[model samples]
Target: EIDKKSDIEFTLKVSYLEIYNEEILDLLCPSREKASQINIREDPKEGIKIVGLTEKTVVVALDTVSCLEQGNNCRTVASTAMNS
Candidate 1:
């Protein structure tokens, strides 16, 4: 349920990640040639955090979908999947 009557009070931080061949990769990056490893850190003040992950800000559904499409295009699809 959504409260349409209330004012928008929160900002969402969206991050895209995909795991393939036992490696976690950022899908939202502009370059697909290099997939970097993301660091999982335990901070005393902030608790658990994922460092070096690219995040995008989205205000609407279209923006979210656009971000998803960008990530999907950057995904590394297997040759087998492409052949099929």
Candidate 2:
């Protein structure tokens, strides 16, 4: 939790993606269509940027977990499946 008296408010944003078959795939996108290919380019000030990536804002720690679960569900199925 943030301090009530703090003057600055922080907002955390995260992006989830995977590199498979020599291509970058965004796992957080809601559409079931083909995963968009992302480009990694170095910017003058920002350094590296992944073009066309979806960034989700996490309000809290619990929200981060929810985003992870959503991205996990979007992962491609493999020969192995684990449930716990």
Candidate 3:
């Protein structure tokens, strides 16, 4: 039934973020220079919201997968005692 509901279209927005060391970074940022510290706040009408985040509208599964891969590549990695 769900699979046959392809005609039911809707907007799908996707965003990626990495939260580490008490900081939130936008993984979808084009460059480090353009990357700004993301913030979370409560809006009276809209409820909790992310202040500044990169969001991309994806039409297909491949598009979403691409976004995920891009963000994953840009993810911050640090050598820890266990990981190193």
Instruction: Please list the residue runs of candidate 2 whose C-alpha ends up more than 4 Å from where it truly belongs after superposition.
Output: 1-5, 32-34, 79-84
Clashes (backbone N, CA, C under 3 Å), per candidate, total: 0, 0, 0
Quality of model 1 by C-alpha lDDT = 0.80
Per-residue lDDT of model 2, residues 4-52, tens digit only: 7688877799888877667787888886453554678999999989987
For model 2, state the Cα shift of residue 41 in Å: 1.7
lDDT of 2: 0.80
For model 3, give the RMSD to the true fold. 2.7
Per-candidate TM equals 0.67, 0.75, 0.77
lDDT of 3 by residue, 1-84 (tens): 968988886789899989878778889988765556568999999999887789999999999999999999989999999899
Full-model lDDT, candidate 3: 0.87
Alpha-carbon shift of residue 41 in model 1 (angstroms):
3.2
Q: What is the lDDT of residue 9 in candidate 1?
A: 80
- Identify the leading candidate in terms of lDDT: 3
Task: Write down the TM-score for model 2.
Answer: 0.75
